[model samples]
Target: MKQLVRFFIIGMLVSGVLLYLISSLNQSQGYTGGNTLTIFNWGDYIDEELITQFEAETGIKIVYETFDSNEAMMTKIEQGGTSYDIAVPSEYMIDKMRQEDLLIPLDHDKLPNLKNIDERFLDLPFDPDNIYSVPYFWGTVGITYNAELLPDKTFTSWNDLWDPDLKNEIILIDGAREIIGMGLNSLGYSLNDTNKAHLQEAFDKLGTLTPNIKAIVGDENKLLMQNNEAAVAVLWSGDAADIMWENEAIDYVIPEEGSNLWFDNIVIPKTAKNIEAAHAFINFMLDAKVAAQNTEYVAYSTPNQAALQYMDPEMVADERFYPPPALTEKLEVYQNLGKRNLAYYNDLFLAFKMYGK
Candidate 1:
């Protein structure tokens, strides 16, 4: 009986050793059992497959969440119930977040792939030196029109949007800065003009466009344009590109008067619980091939210069989406106009919406 008991104990001891070795091996190969990174981003902004790839590669699970608007994202981060390790926000919002101390400075040493970004995108007015952010995607706000519907109309300027023939045939993106800026740009004033008189003039000008405005929408604008529901739309370049891809009849152009040149960048929120994993994700996204794949999926202009080689040559060559330096130089980036001025812009926009109603 004693000999049988000794054999039984030896067998149990060997099994325990084997289980410990297996666990250690799995961990070394990036099989982290509880590691996770939470991301707050714009809806439909990333390729879902990449999330799976990242998790498999690093064993760090992703808790992906999305917001439809920058304001909504900011509000949630400010509320502080959940700890988000990463968030994507536009340039102006990044400026606001930095001011509010809601972001943490990036450690460049961990983000070695940062060198892949184009020099033109870095050291910009917002987040100068990119202390708190890295360029994710960048594009302009402009007009997209259906060639089949407006065969005779070549929209080369913002003023063309006010054409009488276009009445009740135009869709506008639902954003105060974009719509108000369109009015401002039409008047040949700065999109960021903070003057009371200029703002009122812009407001009045938009009031005239009420007759032409078909509908104000968000993501649905793409579907409307694709289905030939609207003749023209004021859209972000990325959204325009997606629409054009679906409907060959669709064409996009930046008006001669210039418009908002915006940048959406990756940032680390102050409430990050997995700082290391956050850095890992940033570096993973910055990889040239990964960046190319993402831009291809999202239909956004990438700031990853090295990634261009991996992108479709014809798509990259399209000047409407990739404007020349001369044109880009003329474009304007939105600035944080402070809370009161921003509210004023929103109020004016709301009043304009009501005017249309």
Candidate 2:
């Protein structure tokens, strides 16, 4: 009887310890069961140190999560089970979300630091009135190639992705919008091609390159290129910047054929329960020093003009951040594709992924 009571007491003690640990973790995450600000961001997009700093400074607990793509982030919110105070989405998505009324018009009066943003990134077509978003990171989609792996291969355009010699030596992005968009741009068409026939052309064009592509990958392009797993890869400038810093043997290019110029912005969601905290976090990020720290950490271009002063001059001079005027003049920004064409693109994307190989 005594042994049974002792065993019960031990079990109770263990349960108590576990409950305490869980509570402590929640507290550390700022879930204090109150005043928590939830942020859904891109994977590894922020300087984590800044998150800690913000938490310490404001005493508002941060509940953080990450989404790999804008579509995935949209689905989560639209499904209505999860709630986040802030989300980072690219240009096209800002338009899509605003159209769907998933975002709240930001109270700029609460965001004085918005002034620090570069004028060039402001008043853009996607969110022209600056009613709903603030530019965070902006970059271009381009190619990264291995010098030794491609020996003597000239890569001045997206046409190179279809070159016969690159068979099984190339990697393409898995995202439907990016892959098809590149195909469209390669043909001198808009990356946001919405016409049914034009999108079909993009699908057919991309299909031709599938036989030569080693794989259609997303974030995996980082390790794939770093290890020289492929001779060339369709990659974003932000990632290209960091990877080149790690491997000098690789180089990036803004294909003369042009590519997508994108901006990922910060916005409060309609479901944001803590508006004050969300605005505070956005304002904190707009601080020049903080913006530079994030850009330096993530290797993405910042829309914060003042942050340039703190950036490495060499990095600033590098074409990855500041491409030649010849290419920049032609870079195209994607617009939201309405339902009909979005489905057309998605259908072709599905068909490509399932049977192209």
Candidate 3:
């Protein structure tokens, strides 16, 4: 009898210990009584310190994930493999997601800090009334050239990239919309031109510049330009700013013929499981000081007007990155061309790449 009683007590004690450990594990994973906010964003796009700070202050855990392209991000979200509370996608992608009902309309009451965003960045065509997205960063696509390598040459327009002197010296960003848009803009056609004839004309024109195209690249374009491996590159303003900061000989220009103006915004995906925590995270990031710090770290143009007070005055005054309303209004924002049109653009750009090779 005594031996049986001892065995029962031992079993009860072990069960209580196991239950305690299980409860602790559940709390850590946010399964039972904790909050977790999952975020999908671009790689190296944010100041990670902010993530830690947010978690510390709000007691909400963060599950951060990154993607290299909008298409990749969209595919993963659509797959329903993981529930994402927030995603930062380009304006065009935001429109695409909205049309497909892959996003949830934002509740403004939870985003009082929305007032900090610049008026110019709000009410955009992609998310009218700021219902589905809020602007994170805005920048122009333009040329960044090593002035030391091309002492006498200046790139005032996209046509300059086709100059014989620049043969085999230019690197273009590897994006169908951007490169194709460049060809279109150079011909005085809309970057978002849907006219097949016009697009063909642009494609044929791009073929003529094949000799001047040394390589088509993505993020590595920044590294190549900084190392002076390429004399000229079609690059985004924020990336140009970063490269120029590292290389004194580098300079950026917005072509006279105009170019793309892109906006990346934050939104809630349809798979969001923690809506309240997501809103808290958004409002936390929109705070003036936080936004300023994030922009400084990422070297991107901030769309939070209130954050300007906390940023360097000189950086704010650089028109190339922070152009006045007049110049920005002249730049075209990418439209959400349907899949067919988008695929057509991609196909033409692929042909252009092959022609260059």
Candidate 4:
């Protein structure tokens, strides 16, 4: 009986020690009993080195994936084939996701860095009061052209692309939203235009421009323009910076009638397994120094006001990255048009794709 009692005592002591070690490790890693969180973001959206730092500090594994289009990202999430913890989608898709009940409202109290964001971006129509998402980067879609090549072209407006002389020399963005939005804006209609007549008119205009188009590529439209495969292309300001960095021949211009300005936000999904860890990662990125580094590397704008103080004064003054207030006045952020309107958009967009092809 004494021998059995000794064995029981030893086993209890061993179990206690093991449990204590496990608890200690968990506390150190902030692993409060949950699965690792998965993140879906655009390529080059965040600095990988920074991400590694976050993972090392928090002990939460972030499974990162990339998609070029918001539609493609939404499709993956909606299919339910894989689980994701966080997704970085632009202004429009965020609204759609919220409407579909695919996103959960965020707890702002958990995110002290929320204060770092500019008040202008907060409480917008999409995710009003900044409840669903935290703004990551914001930019405008505009024309980036080989200015040297088009010295005599005098490109200043969206209509300049339709010049008969430039036929077969222009590259267009392959994404439906951007291409269609351009046509709508050119015709004095909303980017979220739902009227059948307005859409048909835009589609016809696009069809005319399609035949003369050199190619349809996206995100990389600026690259094509820089390589002189095409003289002009519709591209994001960040992509324009990439092109200019590679080949200084190109310059971007916000169309006189204006273009779409968009914000990409970070959000913790309802499926996020490590909520606290996610918040910690977000807060770290929002830190002024970290945010400024990200802005310089990514060639994008941070909505973080504090980060602006850390940015290079020259970059801040650059019209290409930070268009003057007068230029921004002409641009608009798209709102969530209802499902019926989206269906209209899809149908018209598909038609344009088919006809253009």
Off by over 4 Å in 1: 1-34
Candidate 2, residues 1-357, lDDT tens digits: the string is 999999999999999999999999887765864588999999989999999999899998888899988999999988876779999988889898988899988889888899999887888889987899999998999989999888889788999878888888888777778888897998889887787788778878888888788988878899989988888989888888878988899998888888988899999988788899999999999999999898889888888988888988876777867776787878877766778777778788888776546
Query: Against the unseen true structure, what C-alpha lDDT does each candidate score?
Result: 0.92, 0.87, 0.91, 0.80
Tell me the lDDT of model 3 at 175.
94
Q: Candidate 4 residues 82-124, lDDT tens each?
A: 6677889888888888877777777778788888888877888
Clashing pairs in 4: 123-129
Provide the TM-score for each candidate, comma-separated: 0.85, 0.85, 0.88, 0.82
**What are the RMSDs of all candidates, in order?**
8.5, 3.6, 6.0, 8.2
Q: List the residue pairs that clash in candidate 3.
A: none
Candidate 1 residue 262 C-alpha distance from true site, Å = 1.3
- When sorted by lDDT, best at the front, the candidate numbers are 1, 3, 2, 4
Candidate 4 accuracy as lDDT? 0.80
User: Residue by residue across 83-197, what tens digits does model 1's lDDT show?
Assistant: 8999999998898898889999999999999999999989998988989999999999999999999999999899999999998999999999999999999999999899999
Candidate 2 error regions (>4 Å): 1-35, 79-83, 200-204, 350-357
Question: Best lDDT goes to which candidate?
Answer: 1
Provide the lowest-lDDT 10-residue window in model 1.
25-34
The TM-score ranking, best first, is 3, 1, 2, 4
Error of 2 at 231 (Å): 0.8
